[model samples]
Structure formats: C-alpha cells, structure tokens
Target: MTSSAPRRTVLAAALAAAAGAATPSAQAADAARTSEASAPAATPQAAARRSKSLVDYHSWTTTTDWHKGRAQGTGITHGARPGIHIVHPVGTLDYKDPHTGRTTTWDYAVWTSPAHSLKVPATEVIASWNAHTPPATWIAVELRGTYSDGGHTPWYVMGRWTAGDGASDIRRTSVDDQKDGRSSVSTDTFAIDAPAGGLRLTSYQLRLTLHRKPGTPLTPTVWRVGAMGSDLPDRFEVPASRPGQVGRELVVPRYSQEIHKGQYPEYDNGGEAWCSPTSSQMIIEYWGRKPTQQQLSWVNPDYADPQVCHAARHTFDYQYEGCGNWPFNAAYAATYRDLQGIVTRLTSLTDLEHLIHAGLPVITSQSFLKTELDGAGYGTAGHLMTVIGFTKNGDIVANDPASPDNAAVRRIYKRRQFENIWLRTKRYDAKGQVKSGSGGVCYLYFPAKPAPTQHRVLAELGIH
Candidate 1:
C-alpha cells in the first residue's frame, strides 16, 4: 500500500464492498418503518480499511502561476481584462480534407501550470473551471505527476468538458472525464508511477486546452481553472443505526431560497441557484455571526432575504456561472472570522452522526424526485441540505432550504431513505428507484483547528 497504485486498490475495494452488499427492497423498508432491525454492521474487512493511513490534500488555481496573462495559442485574446478567451477563427484548413472541400480551422487557447510540487504523496485528481457564454466547444485538460528523480507520468488527458448551447451558465464537471486517448475514463484517480530506481511523486502540473468551433460569433471565455486530487480517506463502511439515537441539534436558523425566486432574475433568477448560499448563510449565522452591512448593502433594500442574496453574490463562481459551486461555497464560509472549511466526502450518516454528536452540522448534496424522497414533496436536479441531527428512531432531522418559508425549513424523513440519498454513493429517484448521479460530497465548517476527535476525522479524510 506504499505506492501510488494503492489508492486505486482502495477505491476498488470499496466498489467491491458496494457490489457485494445485497440491497433489500420491500423487506428492508418494512423493517425500517416498523422500527425492528438495526442497520447491518460492517464486516471486519471494511472496518480495517476504514482505519488505513491518511493522505493529504493540496490545490492550485489560476493565481498559482507567475504569468497573469493568457498563454500562447491561435485566436486567443486576453479575456475581459484578466481572463482567457478563445475567439472564432475565420479561415479553413484544406490539408486534411479529401472530397469537395476543406475543414474549418479551430481556435485554441491554453493555460499551463507552473513547476510546482507537493509535500505529501498525491492520490486522485479533480478540477473545476469557470467561463462565460461559452460556445459549442470542447475542453481538454492534461495533467502530469513528477517524481523526486524527475520521472513523471505522461500528459494524461484528464478529460474533456464541453458546452453545446448555453453560453453563460456554469457547469461543474466531476472527476470522471470523457477520456480522449491520454487517460482512461473508467478510473477517476491517478497515481504517479514509481519505476524501479525512479522516484516518488513530489510535483504535479496541469494544462487546459480550449477548442472553439469555427465560424461562430461567440467565443469561449474562461475565468479560472482549479485542480486538486483524490485526497479523501477511504472508509467503506458506516456504523449501524440505532432507533431513538439523537444528537444535540446545533441551532442553525433556516432561510427558504424559494422566497427570492423572482427577486434577482439575473443571478440564475435566484431560488434555483440560491441553495448553496442560503445553506452557507444558515451555517454562518448558527456560529453567532452575520454578514457585515457592507456585504448586504449592495442587495436591494426591498429584498427580504438580503443576507441570502449576499451569500449568493459572494460565493458565485464567475466562470462556473452559479452559486452551487462546492469549493466556492466552502471557501465563502472560511471568510467569516474564526472559521475554516473544506470540501470532502463522508462514509455515511454514521460519519455525519459522529460530527453531529460532537456538536457540528454538515451540509450534504443529493438529488431526488418527490416520490423517491417522501417528505420533501418535490424533486431537484441536485440540491444541498444541512444535517442538523437524527430523530430518536434514527430518522433524519434536517434544515431543508427547499421549504416554502423559513418557519417550514425543519423537516424529518425516513432514516433509510435519507441516508441512501445523502450518501450519494449512487443515485436514486423520487420513487426511491436508483438513477444516475454519484454521492458522498459534503461541506464542513467549524472553528479553526477543530476539537481533537473532529480533527482526527478530518485529518484521516485528508480534509483541512
């Protein structure tokens, strides 16, 4: 387990455990609803895996490089004073065509990483980008992992990000890339190869390639490029749930994003895009803090939820084009004095249970239809909700921002249903049928240097 390949082995083991578990349908439901059976215990193997040695996390952004301008490329222009743009090219290329004609030339632009290194052994890799009014174009990312002896992995194609019609909306692409020759799409993690007498990973680099379609008036613009890796610890199993088990519910005031639905039509017209910010607002206020007047001053005075609006504006990723940017939301929480945050995945509600028991609330992501997740009464393409505590019968108590009003935000849902959706190891629909999205993403915010137990968990997960 000392080499880079160990990371993939760990993930494979988790997938194995997931595949082996027999998911009971109707019987499992009867048991949970009847308050009869406790959650199945984790097998010995899974427990051992959960206690494996911890890794570390690091990241680099557009600001990491020394050069502040755009990299060299054709049809490239300085994007909006400090950004990068790929303009449409007017000419065609005849060399590749055989029939009646020539193929149109494509505009290209790139951003290369500096010769930077990491102290800890790196694991998986992930990236996020922001752009405005992107045209029909393809984006390819290349990554390299270097060892102490200078041996490195090839410029592996991290993946391709593409946009067809929407120009200004932000799209958060997951680590699972549409591999185009350089890397395998089957695996999301990357390990630096340690050839015999070679080296261990010490440094890494990233490059972004933008492909703009020819003969279009619109250009593909980029605001920022962020890259990181699979640094979260692998904990495949969660502790069993017990009926009537409850934790001290941290009092987080709730605000309904629905209230701002039509107030700011520009900011994704508000509600659909305000969940992340509203959830952050609740967590920040729970810690006895509030956005300063200056932050809210720009908000329209007539808007009832000014702070929610403030959070949206503050956390919006200009290029990603929305308030749902995960890292951006967590970073916004860090801006409050005496607070620190990181985006990481938890094994299950058992992990959440541990945090809630220790007096911390967690923000988690899940998407479901109204039928799939009972009490919610509606479905979302994707949504963010805060885990406040568990009911005595092991049900979920949450501050669901999707409520129609602030007073209606607190909600309780069946334990099994809630955990299944919140975990995001896979996807589920409104009727509780499995669907497409993967889960395990969460946001954690607390005082700088959390308590020992909390710190140990975060440390093991390679989170801040």
Candidate 2:
C-alpha cells in the first residue's frame, strides 16, 4: 500500500554553492528567497534565471577520519570532520566535536519503521572529497549497519551489505551494488536498479525538494545524487515533487524592504535579509497542518553548545540566552548535537525545516560564521549568516543575502580561518538537555509507527 511514486526529475547538488557574497543588493535582496534561496547566483544563473546570490565555497586540504564509507563491512576511521543524521523521523542523536565542543552531527540516521513488520531500505549515502590526483581517484562508498535490540525489537540490521561501486551489474543482479571508487567526485552519479523493496528517499532527496523540479522528491527514499563511472548510465528516476506543504516564501517582503532601499547599510554593505530560517520555518509550517504549540516549542539553529561560542564567539555567545540548542542563538534558536560526532550541515539549497525533520543540524560552524564576517569585508559588523555547503576544495560557502556593499561577498571563509573562529567558546554538556545530568536512550521509528519515546521531550512540530 505504498503511496503513488512521485514523478522523477534531475537533482540539484545536495549543498548550495555560491561564493563571493560581501554585501546585499537592494535589487538582489528584493529578489532572494531563504534556504537554498540564500545561495549566490549560480555560475549559470545569468544564462538561465538571472538569480541572486546567497552562498559560496573554497576547498582546503583538511581530512577528518570517519567510520568507513561503506556500511556493509567494518567501519573506517578517518579523522573526524563532521556528520549528521542520514535521514530523520525524530529525537535528537547528538555528537559534539572536540574542536567545536558542540554536538551538531549524528553518526546514523533513524527511521520510524515497524519492527518485524516493515523494512525500510537505506537509499543513498555519499561523501565527496578533493582529489589531489585527477582521473583515477578511487571513490569508495561503504554501507554498515549497527543494530540495538536493547532499544527496539526490529531495530536490528539483519544483514547490512553495500550494493554500489563493486557488484554484478543490475542486469545480472537485481539489487543495488556499491559505487566504483574510480568515480569519487561529488558530481558523479552512481546508477543502480531498485530491489523488490525499492528505495527510500534520503535526507539528500529532501534537500533537493525545495526547487520542486520535474524529477524530484523521489519517494522511494532513493538517493538523488550524481554518478561517476563506466557502468554509470547517466540516468535518474526523478519524481514530480511539488513544494510539499511548506507554502509561501519567507523573506519575500523583507527582501523587498532591502531592495527598496537599494542597499543594506546595516552590515558595512549587503542588502539581503538572512534567509536562514525560511527552510526550517517552512518545514514546521508544513508539519503543523493546523498550527499548534508543538511547532513553536524549540528551534535548533546549532548554537546551544560552547563549541559554537568557541568557534564563532563573536557571532553567537555562550551566555546569549537565546534558542534552546543553537550556536548563534542571539535569541530564539535551537541546538541538537551531542554523543559522538557533531557537525553543522548547511546546504545553499538546503531548507532548515527539511534538515531538522531529517535529523540534521540547521546551523553553520563558527569557522564558517567567521568566514562570512570576514567575507563581508566590513569593519566591526555583527551579522548572522547561515552555513550552506562546502566545496571539494575546502571552501565554506554561506547565505548572507543581507550584506550591502559586500553582502554578495559577505562570507566565504577558508577552512582554517573558519575553524579558528569557532574555537573560542567554553564547553557545555551537549548530550544532556536540561543540563544533561544523565544519559538517555535512542530509538528508531518508521513513520507513524512510534519507535520509542519515553525519555525524549517530544516537540509539537512532530519530528523536525
């Protein structure tokens, strides 16, 4: 009884990619949207839609050891960079960074699947890196499954195996296979056929839904990313995704206000409004249906932990007393990182609401925050820019649709510079909510099939 599959369409990059945003353009501000809407004009926008700009990117040579990319076997330990929930249904699984001292990332993604009755397939899990070498960089994507009966009965991964990169062709084997290491770039689209269970959309698919392109919001929970190899047929099963329930565009009027003035005199330059919350708000709105106290309870903008203060102290203070778990929560933000590895995920095209529901952090890193501050080329300016996505080269792109003179180039922090700014805060217990005096349990739910919710303080917003 699966709902009709949505129409398929080509997918946009999971992350936003706009560089050189220093000031806000009155005209630009008047035209900008939030979420992926915050990205700077795409390199091709001028040739297409003549879009405005919102974020940027610059690569670096930093490497973080992560568990092996493939989940089918033992985990690989790369230096810790940052990671977030693969997908989301609810409950916060936090993991703070030793560097940021905040939990903004999650090791695994949980779905509300019915144990012994329902089974959800992991769609697409990908990782990209700068290939010091060209043409022959072996791209490896691994899949590993960890089960915990201590928490839920059907929570166990009977047998987690990968079906990409290395496997018999789908014509020979019906299931998906591991992607080839030869095609390791982020832009590469690994192709495969859906097995009997088909595939479930990943948070990545949700990331691309904002645009509502023809083949989008692939309901199979399939990974709508790129392919990078020979067997790669350069194909995609895009679904006809509409703008979900998140209606109307936030910052529309605000952009109008800025554009009318011709420029944002606020930050030494730009004229754009910080469209950060648009996505997050949209998700909440969609989930609310009739609107309730649930949606308004807490807002995690990745600012609650000391890691943020330490990294981007000047941006969001530790004692600012704002959002529940946010970093730069000058006031009214949300923080959701604790446990093992914490990461702040910001996609230029990403909507906060989408990430939240998928269990990802909607905030930017302190290093990233500083880059915006520095990028603005402003002297003594305090602006709030949201983290979008980074490039293979290590550049941190962001959405600062508000900088006037330098708003367009407001923030494009170097990896090192951004990280330096994020290390000034004092540490707090990211794992514990309400001062986290003790530890709690984690659960996996499959849609309306409640997994386990005894200790978690459920928010009215459902799961975002």
Candidate 3:
C-alpha cells in the first residue's frame, strides 16, 4: 500500500503532511493491603474470569528456573536477579554476520529449557528476553515446538541479540526465511502455516546460546527469557469494551517519524520505518529512562529527536531490515537503566485499561485498511503506536508517530474501531485478500521495581 505507516507501507505523498504523532508490599499487614489494592472493587470471582485463556505466557527467571534447564557449560547465578550465564566454554563457532559480512570466532555455552506445555494450544508464538550483553557478548534465542498432531518442529532462531550496536557486537537481527512446510518464523513470531488445518502448537522449549569472544571472560547474563503463545479466533471485529479510565491521559513526549524520514536510511530507511523503536522510545522515556547524550552523539547534529534515531539504530533488525521486530523493540526498551520490557498479547482493551490505570503506557501493533480506523488517514499492512490513555468517551488517545510533527502526534481514535483493528486476528487487505492482524501484540516497559499497585495490576494481567 502507498502510505506512511512504519515498516510495512510504501511512502506516499500524503505522508509528508501526515507525520504526527505501580507497587507495594508487606507481611501479614502487607497481605491485606495487597488484596485491597489488587482485587477489583467488584468481586474476587470477577478477577478470576479476567484471566484470559486465549494466550499462555511462560518464562524462566529464577535460579530454580535455570536449574530446570539442561545446561552445558552454563551456570545459574544467585541474587535478587538470578539468571543463567556461561561458566565455561562448551564449544566454538565462526559466525558470519550478514549485515557486515564479517566472520568472527566466539566461545559459546547452551541452556535448553524443559518443554513447557501451553495452557491453550496455540497457532502463534513470540519469544522475548531481558539480558545484559556486555561488549563483545550476545545471546541467541531459539524455539522448537511440538504440534498437536505429535509432529515436532526444527529449532527455529527467533532472534540473535545484543544490547549494544558497537563493532565488537554482532548486529541484532531476526532470522528470515526460516520455515518448514507446517510452520514458519516471520520476523520474530513463530506461526503455523495454516491454522485452519486444525494444527496447533501444544508445547515448546526455549534454547539460549550465550556467545562471547573466544578466550575472554565476557559472558551475556540473561535475566529473563520467555514466550507468549496465542490462538486468537479469526474475526473481522472484536467486542467493544466499556471505558474505565475516562479523561485520564498521561503526559507522554512525542516524536514524529515523518519528520525524520531521511535521517538514517541505513536503519530501514530512517524514520519512515521506525514506528517500533519510536514508540519504544516514548515509553522508555515515560518511565524516566532515555539514551544518554553520549549514546546519542553519533546522530547527525541537525536531526531532531536524536534519541528516536538512536532507538531505531539499536532496535534495527538487520535480517528483517526493519525496526518493527516486536521482541527487538522490547529488548531495546530494557537496555535503559532499571527498566524491563516484554512482548505479550492482551486479550482486550480492558487489559490495557488496567495497565494505563496503573500508570503504564503500552506500545501496540496493528494492521488495518484506511476505512477500518478513522483519523489514521492512511492504511497500513502493519504499524505501531503508543496507547497513552482513554478519552472521556472511552476512545483511545494515542501518540501516533505517523504524524507531520511532534505536536500533531497525539490522536484520539474511535474506541470500537481501535479495539477491533488491534485485537482481531484476520482482516481483508485493500485487495480483499485475508491478512493477519497483530492479535493485540504489545510492548510493555516498566520499572524493575514497581509500586505495589502497579505490581498487583501487572500480576493480574499475568505479566509478573
């Protein structure tokens, strides 16, 4: 389609004008406070019903979780943030970086998690992680899944990541062209080739390969690793949700992608394709974290919002050649100090309301025709935007990055329109061919230590 939306649309003349846009704890007394703050005012049964069944999220975060994995030259750390790390080199491999065509030898260690059965058989899965990759170190995340029919999938590379973009580090990217006849890896998602055929992913295992310079003590520390498996029903529309937080817009800074259209073409042709990182930057800063001046010094002095450019460069997926890789954007957000990010699916707008109500902004991915979302002006095969809050009438107030300038980035989209466009799994393209929707894929960034209320809400949403 000819449009300005990031990653998936072609540039159009209209884009030049369109560019716009938690807590607590305590012991016995703490228990009472936690219940009061976390439980909805309605009833405990209501809270139970709120737990969704369309999606299942599983992760390995604690030392116990690490021990459950079959480790080869890997060891678990003990502390407030337990993790798996390379204790000894198990082998060596020569990696040829496609982006730079540079070959380098690195020592590596492997940790394979035990198979995790999904609560719901899923048609799609997206993996995410939080890690500290010091200079010359990085980690690769791979997944192997079992189909409901008892067929097994080959180990698929979900991402090859590093927190840094320096010469010593390999370009963080998603493996492309990875597919079997039954399933495929598109960017960062593992999806069944034909869900309508009655095939589903019943279980899966994650494999982490930690890489570092040969003979060096450097090792990547992985704090968290997990995936979200979902099987959302195919629908052209979703049920509308009642507004809960009316007139509660959070003050989030804005940056327009259209304005930086040609700033850094090497990173997916600059801002025209930078919605993922741009949206990520907004939430990263919303939590009081941002790239330091030193980190942003590489950008041309003339470009505005160099931080956005910085974000784009860091979150760029060389293989996919775009910044819209979901897990990469979340990984980029976690690079900021004291922050954690994850890629997950929310079942409804009420899930968003819970986070926004707890003072969190969400970065959501969606695809729609021009007629599907009013005020968008242009249609997109895919796009990313920050859901800042709700309008008095329950509409969505978003920091849409596809605007003409920073001031024009704030937009209020219709509630039912926004929800359907975001939550639906199937939609008709401009040519009327069926295309996949994001199914409520979102990037959630929050502090490592959240307030009690924020913690409660996040836990309620199955994030903790």
Candidate 4:
C-alpha cells in the first residue's frame, strides 16, 4: 500500500531520469526488466516506486571489507581482512607445567582500524561483527581517542564478549536503565563522556580481538568488523512528520509485544519491553528466516511466541543485563543464514523511503512525548520501531511493536511528527540551516550475496 505526495512526485521524476541516464549491471538490469514486464504500471510515479536498479545500487554497499585494517595475534591466517581467518595453534603450543599443574594458553587475533584524526569529535563508537555459530564466543573491543593537544584517553575496554560465564568477561550493557538513562548492566558500545565543549579527538583507533580456549580444536570464523561514530547532543526536539511522499508498504509480518507480556518477567515481561527483539524478529522473518527449533527450545512450551524469547536470550548482554543493546541487535540479526546487518545513522525520511522502495524495511530509534508523536498514543524516553513503508501522502507506515496485539501492529504516523521523533534532532539552527546530525540512528540488514562496496553509501539524502 502507498500514498502519493508532492515530494514523492519529484523523487519519481528524479529516479526516472537517473534510470534513463545510468547503465545498470547485468543482474540489476535483469531484475528491472523482469519487473517492468510482469508488474502493472501506469504513471511514472508507480514505475519509479517499482524500480529494481535503485535498490541494487544501494544494496551494493550494504557490507564493507575491513581487510585494509591491521591484524595481529597468534594462530591467525588472513581471510579477506583481519579477525576473519583460520586459527590453528600448531607451533610452540601452550604447555602445562607438570610440577604445579598450571598451563598457559594464548590464542587470539586482533584487527585494528586505520588511525585517523577527525574534524568533529565523536562521542560514541559502535562496533559490529559476525562469527561462525556461537556468535560472541571469545571477542573483545578496545578503543582510544587522541586529543588535538596529543593527550589521549587510555585504551578503554568497550566490551569483552565471552560465551560462557566467567569473572574476566566484561561486555557492555545490552539494555539501558529506563529510569536514569544509564546502561542497564552490560557494556557493548563505547561512549566518550567529554565535557560540554565536546571532545576534540585528532585521532581514533578501534581494535577487535578474537580469542579461543587453549587446547580446543574449535575455531570461530569472524566474518567482518565495522564501526560508526555518534555525538549525543544535549538538546533534541522531536518533530512531527507532515504530508507528501509515497513509497511501497511492504507486508512485513507483524508481531505484537502485548502477547508476550508477563511471559518472561526477568526480560521486562516479554513484549512489554522487548520492542528491540520483537522488531528484530519481524525483520529476520521478513527475510525468510526464523529462530531454529533448537534456538527456542529453551523457552517454556506454554509460551506462544518463543522466537521473541529466543531473540532476548541471544541478544542479552551479560554485562549490560539487558536485551536492547543497539549493536547487539544488529549482530544478532547477522547470526541468521544469509542476512547481514549494520548499525549506521540515517539522515532523513527521504533516505528511509529509498530503502523501503528498494524492498528493505528499516528499524529505527526514537524518543518522544505521547503528543509529540501523534497516533502512537504513548510516550517513551526511547523506543525502537520498524519502518516498513510510507503512506500515499508520505506519512510513515510502520510495524510499531508498541501495539498490544499483532492485529494492531501496523500504524501510519504523520511525516514530520514521526521524522522529528525518529531523527531526534533540532529542526533548524539559529542561522536557519538544518541541524544535519544523524541522531537518526538505524539498523540496516542486507543479504550476504552481492556484497556491499568498500565505501558504503549509507545515506540517500546525504544528511549524515
């Protein structure tokens, strides 16, 4: 379903012109030719919305290669990039002292991004990755930022992800404290708490480590590693999304949080607080995958929605003690068969529309008063929702997990109201220029096939 608007009409024209001027790749051309032959089309508006080349173009940069990053560690073999390779500790193996019966086992790998100074200091760093099977078996991330004066923040342990229970494990919070806005208990992401003036970091470096047990033959293959920067400002005014845009409203399966409420009290009573997992589940299923039977077997059989429980368990940050960690959710999605996920900041509703038109639904974060986001009927300091598509007039059509039941999951919000809450930025500065900050954080999932380019074109409107 779609609604028409003035802005969409203009976008329709622009896309048409682009389609004509460009020479698409063979795969993209075939998809476009096939769609045009089979699908009913009349107006330029409808044809623009149904184009495949547009989607393929953006899809090309969904995942990035980190091979250029430096790699260091024992039992490491290269595979495209750092942290992604075969690990076999064969030479000078860790040995046990017969006298004390103590052994020293060291097998690990590290991938560090190229050190680069920045003009605008970043307040937060988000690292995401995928490993074979048991996702975070033995992994940790450390980051450091150097100030213009040459002073540097000592390397901080963003998080140490080890699968089993151990005293040495130090992972970031997976959930946040709803009351005080602090991390719930785990630490997966790193944030530099600079003074009001902001930290002027001249250089930044991120390192990811993959470790293994001393004598085990088991080796985990790390797929890739990537990071993003965020600056959390003090003042953010939520806006209302007004009319005039049209895009496809995908039939993304709906799941209501209400059904799972009280099913698992420890996890904020299931649906009532599992918006992140629920949204994640919906998108994962939309991609034609679901939690395996073994994955959900841990849950009580009486629970109707076991997948939501499965998501919560895997996404739980032991250190954070919560399931809503932003990067963790994206990483969890990547655990599935073909789908790969990335955490990035989107700039505008226009960028979102492109993904939707490309047949991809986006998961987004927002904070707002009930009145600020009309039709939601509820307010939150923060929340996550799935942006499925747009209404004819350009309003947002979403699968809001906030609904009490699956039947009530789909919602259409006013464009400006939804955009304001979704992006969480100032409408304009004193000088009347758009604030242009990407408090508009989102999670993008794409297939492993047709791998994304080295430099991802994440934003359609170039706001970020």
Listed per model in order, the count of residue pairs whose N, CA or C atoms clash below 3 Å is 14, 153, 18, 28
The best candidate in terms of TM-score: 3
> Which one is best on lDDT?
3
Task: For candidate 2, give the lDDT.
Answer: 0.21
Positional deviation of residue 81's Cα in model 3 after best superposition, in angstroms: 2.0
Please give the lDDT score at residue 179 for candidate 3.
79
lDDT of 3 by residue, 358-430 (tens): 6777899888888988998988888899998888888999999998899999999999999999998667778
Q: Model 1 TM-score? A: 0.56
* Candidate 3: Cα lDDT at 251: 69
**TM-score for predicted model 3 compared with the true structure:** 0.90
Mind giving the per-residue lDDT tens digits that candidate 4 earns over 1-464? 00001111221232223223322334333433433343332346533432321111111111133545665642333433233543543333343423234454546656666775443455445556655434324665566667655676666655544333233222323322211121111244444333233344455676666655656555555665556654444335544434433656776878876688777666544557778888888888877778779767779999877898777766665544456666677777877775677776665576676566555678997756667778888866457789988888898899988887889999989888788766753333344433322367788765555222101223322211
Worst 10 residues of 4 by lDDT: 1-10
| Candidate scoring better on lDDT of 2 and 4 | 4
For model 2 the TM-score comes to 0.22
Question: Which regions of candidate 1 deviate over 4 angstroms?
Answer: 1-49, 52-245, 428-435
lDDT of 2 by residue, 1-464 (tens): 00000100101111110000011223212322233343332234332221121111111112221221222211222232232112322222343322234433212322221111112222222211211111111112222221122211111111111111111101001112222321111111221123113323221211111001122221111111111111111111112222221222222111111231212222112222222222122112122211233432232333221121121211111121111112112111111111111112221222332332232222332212222335544321112343434444445444443443223423455544443333221112223211100000011111111112201111111121
**TM-scores of all models?**
0.56, 0.22, 0.90, 0.71
Candidate 3 segments whose C-alpha is farther than 4 A from its true place: 1-43, 50-52
Pairwise lDDT winner, candidates 1 and 2 = 1
Superposed Cα deviation of residue 285, candidate 2 (Å) = 9.5
